[model samples]
Target: MTAYAVGQLRNVQMNDGIVDYLHGIDATLAPFGGRFIIHGGTRETLEGSPADDLIVIAFPSKAAARAWYVSPAYQVLVPLRLQGAEGDIYLMEGVGSEHRATDILDVG
Candidate 1:
């Protein structure tokens, strides 16, 4: 199944810290079959204010995603992500195919 990780980032305050985290995060996601599907782009506001950044990543399976996230290497980056940005993150699984609610959460 395909899993996705989605994030909405606002008030990003730590520049250098996030940069470093991303460097390590990119490398960590590779072996787990993770890829960025959305790398944050512009959008027209329709209602409430939206965050400046939105990101989505796909993974082969929910287990693969979970494994990557809990791995020692990536776990260290969690705090950086939290302290650097104010946002919400969620995992959803695709349906009918490899993508299901279970699959979406599996992405790292």
Candidate 2:
């Protein structure tokens, strides 16, 4: 199933390390078929206040997402991101195309 790596980042420090991380991330993602679906940009707030930046990267599958996150190429950049941003990054499996809202009722 398709999966995503989502990040809710705040207190970002735009330093050289962060810039280097940005420069190197794409090369690492290419091999694993990961692409950014959302990167902190303009948004219309309809509810509670949200100051943190939201980032979402979609991958072919959970395994692919996990692999890309821990791969040597990407791991080297992890520290830079951690040093630059305070946030949480997590992987989540996606629902199939035929999924329905009522599907939650089936969850045990």
lDDT by residue for model 2 (1-108), tens:
999999899999999888999999999999999999998679899999997899999999999999999999999999999888998899999999999999989967
CA RMSD per model (angstroms): 6.1, 1.1
Measured against the true structure, the TM-scores of the candidates, in listed sequence, are 0.76, 0.94
Q: State residue 44's C-alpha deviation in candidate 2, in Å.
A: 1.2
**For residues 2-89, could you state the per-residue lDDT of candidate 1 as single tens digits?**
8988788888876877878887788888888989999856687899976568888899888888777788988898888876888887
Model 2 ranges off by over 4 Å = none
Worst 10 residues of 1 by lDDT: 94-103
Candidate 2 Cα RMSD (Å)? 1.1
Candidate 2 local lDDT, residue 25: 92
Instruction: Score each candidate by Cα lDDT.
Output: 0.80, 0.93
User: How close to the true structure is residue 63 of candidate 1, measured as C-alpha lDDT?
Assistant: 84
Best by TM-score: 2
